[model samples]
Structures are given as C-alpha cells and as structure tokens.
Target chain A: MRTDLCDLLGIDHPIVGFSPSEHVVAAISRAGGLGVLGAVRFNDAAELDTVLTWLDRETGGRPYGVDVVMPSTVPTEGLPEDLNAMVPSGHHEFVERTLLRLGVPPLSAAQDRPGVLGWLHSVARAHVEVALNHPIRLIANALGPPPPDVISQAHDRGVLVAALAGRADHARSHVRSGVDIVVAQGYEAGGHTGEIAGMVLVPEVVDAVHVPVLAAGGIGSGRQIAAALALGARGVWMGSLWLGTTEYQSGHALREALLRATSSDTVRSRIYSGKPARLLRNRWTDAWSAQGAPAVLPMPLQNLLVSAAHDRLMASGDPTVVPMPVGQIVGRMNEVRPVAAVLSDLVTEADETLGRLHKLL
Target chain B: MRTDLCDLLGIDHPIVGFSPSEHVVAAISRAGGLGVLGAVRFNDAAELDTVLTWLDRETGGRPYGVDVVMPSTVPTEGLPEDLNAMVPSGHHEFVERTLLRLGVPPLSAAQDRPGVLGWLHSVARAHVEVALNHPIRLIANALGPPPPDVISQAHDRGVLVAALAGRADHARSHVRSGVDIVVAQGYEAGGHTGEIAGMVLVPEVVDAVHVPVLAAGGIGSGRQIAAALALGARGVWMGSLWLGTTEYQSGHALREALLRATSSDTVRSRIYSGKPARLLRNRWTDAWSAQGAPAVLPMPLQNLLVSAAHDRLMASGDPTVVPMPVGQIVGRMNEVRPVAAVLSDLVTEADETLGRLHKLL
Candidate 1:
C-alpha cells in the first residue's frame, strides 16, 4: 500500500478518495489515503468553511485535501470564439422544463433557491483561497489544468497542485504548467468525462507527463487499483464508490437507487449537466434521449436550473427523474460499508490480484 | 495522418478500417491502409468461401486481412472444447423465457436455428485456412491471443499475426509469445472488450510489449485516430463506422440505427453475446437490466439465444430489441456514405488534429 504517493502525502496507501461531503473526506484521510473534498457542488463559501472545520476537527490532524472544477473551455473565457451564444435557447428551455417536470411539489417552492452560479471561476477561486488558509495538503482542479495564479498560490502555501486530465496532451499541459500531480480521469468515471476512456487514457497520461499520474475513472476495488498501479499510475483517485458507502451524504431515494444499481445501470448522458457525465440512468434520461426533446444546456446553466429541483426530487423519493452520478464501476457496489472496510478490502484484493499477476509474469 | 502506426502498417495513414463485409474491406485496402474482414459471424467453409472470394475479387490483389475470435482461455486443448454443455441450461431457459415473455415473434419457423453450437472453432479454423489459402497479408485474433499452433501456422504462411489485448499485461503475453502486432482494444471499443478503456490501454500495451500496437476503441474521426497514433500506437483499427457504409450488408433497421445515433447514444452491454459488447441501448437491454433477470450467459450461448431473437427483431422493424454491436463512436456515425469516404475523412481528420496537437506540444 505504501508507494510514491504515500511518501508524498504521508499516508499509508495511494488511494485518494474524492467526495463532496467533508465527513467522508476526513474519515478516509484518517483511514490512511487522503480524502479530497470536492467543492463544485456547494453554493456558499460559509458551508465549505463549516465543512472544512468539521473535517479538521474529526481527522485529528490527519492530512486531507480540496478539489474544484477548472474547465479547459468555458462560456466565460471566450475560447471557441462563439460558444456562449452558440447554444440555442430551445436547449436551455428543454433542460429547465425537464427539471421542472421531474421535481417534487416542494421543488417549485425552492425554485428560486441559490444555485452554484459564478461558481466555476469565481466561487472556485474563493474556495481555493479559503482552502489555502487551512492546513490543506493538496488542492486539485478538475476538468483541466488549473489557472496559473492558483498553481502559484497553492505552491506558496506548501500545498501541491493537482489537475484532472482527460487526454495525454492535457497531462502534458499540467506538467508544463507546474502541476505537482495529474489525475487522469478516463470516460468510465462518474463525473464529467471525455471521449478517451481509462484503459487507454491512464497510461497515455502517465507517459505524457513527468509528474506522478493518479488513475481515475471507474476504479472501485483493490484489483482495479492494482491494475492502475501495474499500468504505471502512481495512485488511484476515485469518486463513484464513495457514493454507496455508509459515510456518504445522500437522500433516502438517491441512496436506495445507488444501492440497487449495477454497472449496467448507468449511462454517460448529457441530460443532467449538459456535459457527457456518467450517471444512473432512469426514466428522465430515457425521456430526453427520445425525439422532440431539446438538447441539454451547457454547464453552470444546466446545473443552475436543476440543482434545487434535483435536491427536492431526491428528497421526494422520485428516482424516475433524479440523476445519481456514479461510474460504470457502480455495478460492483452492491452493499453499504464503512470507509475503512472498503479501503481495507481494496488493499487486500489488490495484494492478492497483484500476487497472482506476479506469478504469471 | 502519418504516424508511428503508419510506419508500422506501411501505409500513408495508420487507420485500419474493419468490416464484416469484404467489399468495404477491399475499398479500405485500396484506399491506403489495411482493411480487415470480421469472421466471427462468418460461418464455416461455404459462408467464408463466398465472403473471401468477394474480398479477393474486389480488392484486386491488394493486401487485406481476416479477423477471428480465438479465445486463448477456452476449455479445450487438442480438440476445440464444445461450450454447449458448459452454458447452464438455466441461462438458456432464462433466454427462452425472456423471448417468450417479450412476445418477440420468431425470425423463422425453422426449429433448431443455426447457432454457435458445434461450429465456432471449426469456422474460425476454416476461416484461417481460407485466409491462408488467399493472398492475404495479416490475421487478427479477437477474444484472446491466437493459439500457439495457429500463430505458428499463420506465420509459416508469411501472414503476420496480431492479437487484441485489453490490458498491457495481455499485450505483454502476446509479445512474449512472439506476436507481430498487438491490437489494444479499449473499453470504448465495440464487440468483445477488455475491462480497461482504450486511452489508458494504448500506452500500457505500447510500453509493455516489444511488438507494434494498434489502438482500437472509440476511434472514428481523424482526431481520435491522431490521438491514438500520438499515444504510441503504430496503427488504429475501426469497426462501428463500417456498418453505415454502402458495402455493409446492413438491414434497413440497423442502418437507420447507426445513422440516427450520435456520440452520446451508445453503451456497452453484454446482452448480445453474454459478453460486454458496445451497442445501441434499447428496450431489450433495458428489460434484462431491470430487477432480477438471470445474468447473461457467456459467449456463444448468449449469442445463440440472442442471435435467433435478434434476427427476428431486426426483421420486425423494431430496433428496441434488435440493437446490434457497435462502438461508443456510433453516436458520431450520423450518415451513410461510401466506406472509402468515411475512411478518408478519418485520415483527413487525423491529419488536421495531429497538426493542431503538434502546435500545443
């Protein structure tokens, strides 16, 4: 379990768990592998601060980190020349209407609830700054290379900067931009993914960059982790498996749905986030997939329209419309267990699989 | 379009277009790179005779190859293992019950419809024998590495041997066994696939083996081809795009499915062959995925039951149950044109994408 990543992070294993809940983050960190608290979902800075404080108190000085989204292309950055107005209004309307139709009665009441607006850039930056003030060991940027200033700032705080890359070229960008780590997320991953899936993506990124490559995408078990390490990834960064654990923060319905799911139960659909994110497929994703429905709206905008409604739908036990972001590996997550138990299982299974593999070699 | 793969394949481009139909194979072969004809569906002696004759006549003596499904781990030795009894009767009953329950009308009134029983190995051997009998240049094995005797036989004929590997270790085994080429089939690929996706699989295989590697997965457009080549692949093998071409013997329903598909529409399901193969998800796949249905039987058994129903379902003009095998890139297969045009576009796109990518480098 002790590898290059363990040496760098002062942890027992190279298993870096990514999750939205701070409690799970702290729990996993205490267990050994660093737990990275994802910041894309939170609306208020105070909530993040509260979560961080709780994590700090619970971990008893164990190392933990924070992650945020830094997309390579954005509507605000003006990269593709004409991407902002490029998306049709019908698409936006369709997304909004679908969320409206899927939401519970209380969702309409919370329709005007504060959303993750201006979060991609501004809020993400603010959270990073807040994270820097704390005893954070690492700061990771998802979707692309981190902004230049964020890299320098994290470096100034003795915090290592990590970035998620979908391609080898992106991994090269991370290395060139002074990233301490490159998290290679393949398409089998639960969140926003690109065309390149993990089996090819991981090693390509490993070869493309000089920095340590942490394998991400559909990695849930010890054997998978072993395969990643064997493929030359220094560590494994996972998200989907964390959702099914007892430590995960989830509504009754979403938890039930996740528990019921298998690997075949998910799909990489754009209906939820406008990006091709892997999520548990249900009647909602099915409806949009049919004819006559408008396309999904792009980022923050789609999230903006669906967030509160999503919250209400989950609370109302309406899984027909509520999307649960989980990777294809979710199929193996058939039971609820503690973070420590899951971590132990992964290490043990990986040891067994690696031992067997070594025999073959 | 020039790459390490082009250098290895001895072509102007690294693209290797795959088609079950030989006409498309010849068209791709004459265009520049190799064209591989799939032989899994090609029954024994006579059926292969017709197809190979068509390919040899059309290609005008140009170099082409045949792809076979040779599983190294099959439960056979001197004589091929008959997997009929190995497939649990429970699984077959499940299939029969499913068809009966779904009310899918039979494709033919004929009893004991032609199945994978008593044939695959002989068909595969016959295909190899016929291919060797032809003026072909290469032979590829899909399910696993080709048997040592087959490899030796193929090499003795001066026809190069290639094996599809889903992992670096698999590629390493092929290399150790003296395979000339290793096709890295990523999870993004259609048909029987390895657990690992292509992006990660490519470099791992490339780095692990001494032999040349061909990237196979969700590759379609030239950009994806360029990415594969850039990731240390010496060639790229494409499959899904061929189904939409003029030379393909596609039924009207299957062709419409491919034309209507987008990059977002496909998924990898084992519903067809009792193995995870990418295809357009439909009602049949959905039904099996629902609640507690018997798990899909492995390989030929699943193919036997599903193939019979598939024949009927496709003829019935309802794609909901007749979804055929394809890749994740089927979503990008939005038109039907000459296979040569598609192959050309892929090469052209690869060239443009490579140029842009080099700028970043």
Candidate 2:
C-alpha cells in the first residue's frame, strides 16, 4: 500500500483523510495518515490560526494539512450581511418555504453566520497565511489552482500545494500553475465534483500530469484503495468515510441518518454552494429539486443564502432537513468507529488485499 | 490473467467483448476471448438465426454468447405502424423539428423499420429460442434478470445465464433468480446504466452475491482489467472499446466523431431509449436536452419515435447528428484496429500490470 506519495507527504501510509473537524484531522495525523482540516467553516483568520495552533500541538509533531476553498473565478467579497443582501428574494423564499414545509423549526435568536466568506479569494488567502504560520506540511485548495503567489508562498514555507481536479485538463493546468499534487475528485465525490468517475479520471489525470495523483470519490475500503492504485493513482484522498467517525462532532440525528443511507441515497445537485456537490438526498436536497424550485444562486451567494437555513435546520435537530455533503461511500460507512481503529483497519486490510492480489499473478 | 470465469466460459483470457457486429464477435472468440453479440438489432428471428449460423462457422467452434434486452416490466407489444400511431403528435413534431434544425435529412422510403420489438418479452423469447438452437455458451440479459423459465431453459441446454446489475441488492436478486454470473455495470458504462460507479459497485456486488462477478463500464485497457481483479471481479465485460474496431459497421462519420471524443464527451440521457443510457454527446443529444424539448417517452416508444430520425441522421452523413451509444471509454478508442490485436494488447497489458502489482506487494 506504500507509494511515493507516502515519502513526499512524510506519512507512514498513502491514505489522506479530509474532514472539517479539527479533532478528526489531528487524530488522523496521529494515526499515521495525513489529516487535512477543511477551512471553509472558519471565516475568521484568528479562529483558524487558533485551531491550527491547537492542531500543531494535538498532532504531537506529526504532519497534517489544511484545505482552503479558492474558486478559480474571483467572487464578490463582503461580510455575511452584504452577501445575504445580494441573494434573490425568490431563492430565499423558496428555501424558507421549503424548510418550513419540511418541519424544520426556526431559531429563536439569529445565529452568528459566517456567510461562507472562506470561499472568496481574500479570505482563502488569509487562510493560507494562517496555515503557513503553523507547521503544516501541505496546503490544499478545494475548487481550483491556488494563485501563483499562494503557491510560491507555500513553497517558500516548504509546504506542498495540492489542488482538486475532476478532469485531465484541469490537472494539467494545475501542474502548469505550479501545484505539486492533484487530487482527482470524481463525480461520486462529496463537495463540488466533475462528471468523470474515479476509475477513468484517475488514470487520465495520472497520464496528464507528472505530479502525484490521489484518487477520490467512492473510495472507502481497502479494496477500493488497491483498485485506485491499480488505476495508476499514487494514493487515495477520502472525505466521506470520516463523517461517521467518533471524532466527527455532529448531532446524533445526522449520524443516524448517515448510517441509514445507501449509495443511492445521495444526489449530485447544484443546490449546495451553487456548484454540483454530491449531498445526501434528504428533504433539503429533494425540495430544491422539486418542480418550480427557483434557480440556485452562484458561488458564495448560494452558500450565504443557505447558511442561516443550515444553522436553523441544525438547531432544529431534524435529520431529514439537515444539509450534509457526502459521497456514495456513505453506503459503506455503517458503523461509528474510533479514528485509530478505522485507520488501523484500513492499513491492515490494504496490506492483506495487496498480498492476495500478488498471489493472483 | 485467468480466473474462474475463464474456465467456466472456456476462454483463454477473462475478457468478454460485447458487440452487435458478428465479425467482431467471431474475431474475439477466435482470438481466445468470449464475445457476446447483441440481439436487440435483430428483431426478426430469421435474421438472428442467419447471423448466429455465420458466427458459429466463423469462430471455428470457439465459445460465444448472446445478449438480449428484457425489461422487468412488461411493455406494450405491437407492430411498427401500430406503435407508431400511439406516439403523440407533439412528440413526433419535436423529433421532426429537432432533426430539421440539426440538418439531418429525411430517410429514403422509411428504411424497413422493425419497431424495436426485441425489447418485448415475446420477441426476446423468440430470440432466446433461435439462440439456444445454436451452440451459444451463455445467455445475457441487459435490463434485468432472466425469468425462471428462461434461466431453466438455458441451464437445460448446458448454457450459463448472466445478468447486469448496478447495485449490490440488484446483483443479489439476480443470483437468487438463478444467474450464474453477475456483470457489475457502472455509471460509466455504455447504454442503460445505474447510478453506482464501477470502483464501488464491483466490490459491493462481489460481497453480496456468491456468483462470479464481471466488472463492466469504463474498462478499455489491461490496467483497468487488473484493477477490476483487485476489486474482486472474476472478469471484465467490455462494450464501448469494440465500437472503434475495424469490424464495427458504423459509418465513417460516426467513427470519426468517436475517435475525436474524450472521456467527457458522453452523457447519461434517457433520450436514447427512455432509460438512462450513456451516449455520445452531439447535436442530437444536445437538442433533446435543450429547453422546450419534450420529455422523453418510455422505452420502445422512445426507440421507435426516434428510430427514423436516427436513420435520417445516418443518411445525412453528419457526425454531429448521428446517435451512438458509447461509454466514457470512447476517449481511448483512438484508432481502428483488428479485433485480434485489441484482445492481444488487453491480455498482454493485463499480465504486465499484474506482474507490476505483484512487485508492489
């Protein structure tokens, strides 16, 4: 199961775990796999800096990474109120009406919303600045290639820059933009993804770029990791598999819903963050796809438009109306295991799977 | 490179080439792989009988198979004219207007249409009757499991029954219905496919059903075959790779379009057969997807309604309007080679890939 990626990333295994939970991130790093903390949930740079500082201490000198959302196109930058004002009333009404109809209760007090300003270039650049101030070994961008300045800044700090790509051309362009690694995220992946599946996209991206490629999407078990490597991927980047871990801080209702989900329980809809993100097919997603639903807003506006609604739904503790981004691998995430146990099982199973495949030759 | 599937099917390699061209089928079998001929094109029993007779002689006693379409639900059965009259005028106008807008010329004197009766139980039963009289080694159904009677009939003649499934539950049901082999067709596969991608679907199906599973969809190389084996599939069933072989009878224009395409050039749309089938994205598919286009009718009607337009597009010699059912693997079909060479390359590359993976262990 070892590859060049393990050496490059300074990890014991080639597996990379991605999650928004800082506990999960530190736990993964301590477990010998690279844990990447998703920074989209942090709008304040100081808050992110505090978390990274804690991560640096919690990981016990092990290497970890930070993932920031930087869309290729520069979006309108503002505070939460300004972005909320930009959202169309029809779209807002649709969300409100649908949430109300789905029995999602409202918040008594207005929750402090961050507006997903982290998706904007200005904030993501701040995230990079905060991330570099720590001992992070890798800096990852979600939607596109980090700016040349960001790439050079990370390089100067001796950190590798990785960008997620769904297509071969995107990977080549990422390499041209000076990225060190390309995460080939497939259509079955959570968050924003491209149309090609990992089985095809991984090989295509590997052929297109010289950098190490980590196959993403629909990869949960050891067999899937071996299959990804056989398809020419140097490693695997998994996010959905971590959502059910004990380290993931979420309500019991959401964990229960995820445990009950099958692979078919997810749908790729633009309703999430105005991009085609694979999300659980719950009442929230289904309502947006229903007849006469207003067209979703773009980029940060969509995220801002739905942030308050998300908070309300979370506050309500209603699983059916809660919004969660997950891949088809959710079907296989049947149990809640500790982070150490899950990582141990992944490595052991992969080693056994590789040995079995060797005998086939 | 061999698995239990090879010994069961009596082939040298665990590869199954699926094509509607008898020449391609015979070439695959003679080259030491099993080739399955698609029977949907032969609505007439006599026509299918003639082709099977030629295939039996052409392969020189090698093993081959036949694929028939049998939807789980019973569809309305009638002659071409009788079914054609049931099509709404608006739907007819949409097809006519679409073809006219796309510059597809009218066909010459209706072209002796057969009305896709092959999708019905009655016609498919006749197809099985004609196929069983020959030396066919296997019988495969595309849409669903073969009925109990059909499975028993094949078993009585010492023939194996295989069915395609996109989900673990579907594969289990197929095995329960007496299917010997289950083909885990992924979303990247050509023609009608389910939502699960191959990387996740293959392992899920293998764990669910005790029968041997053949990995299908997005497989066009030996490296993919090795990956499939790593994911626990006993064999690989390929369809799109054969479309570009020299034995395929498609027009030069359509062939050129296929060669020029990349992995992103295909879309899963119901316009092809009212089922979500992957097809080459072209002007025809684009028009049907555009706004103001009528909703695609259910199967058999959708096929009949667009059959003449498909013929007209073929006659127009316009690559942009021709309808072709292909998978994401079309991107790798760069040149037209003999079927024997393709099979040889697949086997050689697979062996080399297996050897390399063995060293990784």
Name the top DockQ candidate. 2
What's the TM-score of every candidate structure? 0.57, 0.98
Q: Taking the true A–B contacts (Cα pairs closer than 8 Å), what share appears in each candidate?
A: 0.11, 0.68
Off by over 4 Å in 2: A110-114, B110-114
**What DockQ, between 0 and 1, does each candidate earn?**
0.07, 0.75
Model 1 chain B: worst 10 consecutive residues (lDDT sum): B352-361
- Give the per-residue Cα lDDT of candidate 2 at A148: 90
Question: What does the TM-score come to for chain B in model 1?
Answer: 0.90
TM-score of chain A of each: 0.91, 0.98
Interface RMSD for each of the candidates: 11.9, 1.2
The Cα error of candidate 2 at residue A14, in Å, is 0.6
- Model 2 lDDT, full chain set: 0.89
Chain A superposition TM-score, candidate 2 = 0.98
Q: Please give, for residues B4-25, the per-residue lDDT of candidate 2 as tens digits.
A: 8889999999999899899999
Best by lDDT: 2
